[model samples]
Target chain A: MVNNKGLLIVISGPSAVGKGTICKELVKRGIDNLELSVSATTRRPRQGEIDGINYYFKEKEVFEKMIEREDFLEFARVYDNYYGTPKKNVMDKISNGKDVILEIDIQGAKQVKRNYEDGIFIFIMPPSFKELKSRIVKRGTETQKDMDKRMTCAFEEVQQAKYYDYIVVNDDLNSAVEKIYCIIKAEKCRLSRYHIDLSGFKEEL
Target chain B: MVNNKGLLIVISGPSAVGKGTICKELVKRGIDNLELSVSATTRRPRQGEIDGINYYFKEKEVFEKMIEREDFLEFARVYDNYYGTPKKNVMDKISNGKDVILEIDIQGAKQVKRNYEDGIFIFIMPPSFKELKSRIVKRGTETQKDMDKRMTCAFEEVQQAKYYDYIVVNDDLNSAVEKIYCIIKAEKCRLSRYHIDLSGFKEEL
Candidate 1:
């Protein structure tokens, strides 16, 4: 019998690549024995957001203290707000045989990769840069200058996808989810992650 | 657009472990863009066996000459019979983007590993040695001494599974087939095997 450990799947993509949507669909499909890691942030919670559920809302001082204590797996400061992944939450879930998905940006994913080399890194990609631009424009949330900056950032992000373990193109939502589901299942069968206990069989022989 | 190359999947297991059944089920289920590699053997074919379908029946001298020419991806001498995988058949199919599955014994698998390091090696496993013995006994084709020899050989074969890339336990035939299918699909998504042409995207950006 092989009692396999859980997998730490780190997902990264540029803005408007549908990484969040794919993750949501995977959770909605009820992937067996999986959990979404909750991230902590120093930003204010939205009206409908609840503490510990939507995000682990933290004060600036408290977030800085945790950072100093090395309690975060990866952290960053953006526009005076700190966002980080809590190390304990991920470690506890994985140790208890729950596959954990960390949906982060490329920079954060790179930092986590340094600490967890065995983690499966997946980069969600748009079908093309043209489609990516269209999607961003369709969102109607950015100015022309903002969109240009985001497109440049996306170009740089897609370049780093070569370093990731796998890349799923987000042309169709359901199809992308199915591809990711297959990747996770196949990864579980990898011999590097599984160790068969042949003691009982040896005894019979 | 990533026009990925086909995968060379090498499947190996102990005798009577249902590798043939799983491969048949995979084909029956219509695994898209996949084919089973035809093996070359010097042994005499049984009744109903076709020249190029079941096996490529070859004369001993021809097989020997092919071996001298290094025409086999892998080959071995079993008793007085020469069994081998022709390099051309596998290479042709894979080069055309058709995934090829090679079902071979452990010894032949090890030889293939040395040559095709990029190929994915998968080991099929019986649920237990006790169940394995029962299955072999149920087949009703082996004498008592022959059965004992097979059981001993199986023990040694299972031990080599640790070197494989993936392991699928054949507790249920359909489940094993599904696991292998997932492995093939996931391998296609691997960043190393797949290269997305970003030159077009670069022009658009």
Candidate 2:
């Protein structure tokens, strides 16, 4: 008896909660059967970005069409640009016994939870409100009004943490990574995930 | 905020399935906040057994009265002796922020689940039927008739594994111990367990 399929892991929080960095570290640990889910975007690629490697670039019209056909697991249009996780890419990897992790914002996480309640939903939390504000301020790219808006958004997202299965405080980087890694290992032991073949045990008896 | 109460962890399987061994190893790992729940039994303690260390030796009448008062979390009468887990002992530790683990048989586990569904239930499984039978035979204390009865009981217990939250196979002792350790750590991260003080994170902002 084996777990024939992999788990769908969603890491979510406010924009500056460090979900991206944690996911990067987990992937770089060289666990062979784990993968990060890639998103399709309607925005321009950056200088060093590759077409399929960085993001699945699509025209706005084509992205809207895919949304109509439900090709994306979760998608949202933000200030004229569309971003979404393609359903096929994530589903195929899971079927092939590779755990696929998605680092998305609160809205997309809620969408994925609605569609698949069995996936592991983890909410990464900043140590405190002060720390969250400082992280955003350190980026030094936003105006005072914009930073205030982001902090308000972060406050709203922190309230949504209760809905997720696990809440990991992103206080220490190594400790946070270790906790998430433990969560992944523990999920593998869940009885709901395994197709236990007890028939052979009984038959041989 | 901290999780005010500790988790009630139940490790269960058929007799001789190594549930007791795993629990011992986990406690011996010196996780300071973890403790094993001691059972009160009407049977005479073996030579050199301490009163509260190995088992809480109890008189039959006292055990019966306690059961009537709903003092035991779960209890059962086996062959002439009454064995049970005292509710106060386990609950007090949990209230003091120490996780209490119970290593019990399948029937006792069922009773605990009925009383407290929030507890973490883990089932220990042998690698295969052949390995299970050989382990029983190697014990060399049971008669042939008793051995057959125990094997039949084991076969029945395997079917109940589905009802548990996690299933750990005892193929390798170290691996099984490590998996259970990870499970404990992950459970602490569960949203339901933590008294999340997001209120501070919001109010301070």
Candidate 3:
């Protein structure tokens, strides 16, 4: 009855498309028994972000050492900073029957796919490119050039949407979140993901 | 952004595991847009049966001729009666953007899988074999011997669980139906199932 192992869910989307917001919704609701996979980064800690909670902030030299050791499952340089997913923690969580979720950029998402093709990749898309621009503008942190760069990055990022397993359109927040949650719940019922020994069951006879 | 395509879903379960009950719940609730794929059979129509509604009943010779012509996707002979799925009708419905569901037996399910490998296969099971037998007895349509024969058949059917994409435990009717509905919704969001064209979109170059 209780034989499911776990699932590794990778979610990728353009910035300002609410990937973090939806992930926080999932975490807050505690639906489908999922745990967030915190990333390791070489970037300095922000004002309020906890070292372990937001990220395992590492020194540039240490991060470079890990990269040389091939310890990170996926690593990338973003906006002059380094970000990588540590292999050990993610694998450990999944192996222990806890569903692990990685909210990653398109590059890291692609790398994870190359390593673990079995992992579920979900792409979140904005309603339209126009709406996408407005969302970024509303954030009030970026210059016009910064906004342009992000939009450029988004166009290239969405090109990888075809590589994803699921594409959730983030038109409506609640509906989009529900779709992602349902996907997770439904995926848990997959027979291939379970630990059942059907061959040994008396039903075989 | 709007492309209409149909999906074929194959659902199977052991006798008295309440496949019909759960499917009816889904249909009644209009949870997911799905059309039931009624099969064609050569067996004599029992009392209160509606031709074309319950089944597309055909003469034995007609069924045999169709089988000879390879028109049936999968055909089987049981107790001197023939049963099969019409490939043309199912394909037509699917191509028109209708999701078709085939409630089938283990043998038929295997045959459909062999022919239509892209179809979604879902297997329903009771919480335990004890619960299964209890359900059969509660039905009151079978004698003790009949019940044993059905149980034996169920045991044999359970062996095919490994071949299915999903194994849903029918512990609670409402929950099982909800899970099935979620699976359908989630599958529609699959990148492989649907695609969007971004060519017309204005983006920062």
- The per-prediction tally of clashing pairs is 0, 0, 0
Candidate 3 ranges with C-alpha deviation above 4 Å: A1-3, A78-81, A141-148, A203-205, B1-3, B42-49, B77-81, B141-149, B202-205
Clashing residue pairs found in predicted model 3: none
lDDT of 1 by residue, B1-205 (tens): 7755788999999988989888888878888888888999999999999988889999999999999999999998989999999999898888899999999888889999988999999999999998899989988888989988888899989999899999999999988998999999899889988766788888988
Ranking of all predicted structures according to lDDT, beginning with the best and ending with the worst? 1, 2, 3
Worst-scoring 10-residue span by lDDT in model 2 chain B: B196-205
By TM-score, who's the top model here?
Answer: 1
What is each predicted model's overall lDDT from 0 to 1? 0.90, 0.90, 0.84
Q: TM-score per candidate, in order?
A: 0.96, 0.94, 0.88
What is the TM-score, restricted to chain A, for candidate 1? 0.96
Better of 1 and 2 by DockQ: 1
How good is model 1 by TM-score? 0.96
Worst 10 residues of 3 chain B by lDDT: B196-205
The per-prediction CA RMSD against the true structure, in angstroms, equals 1.6, 1.9, 3.0
| Selected candidate, larger TM-score, 1 vs 3 | 1
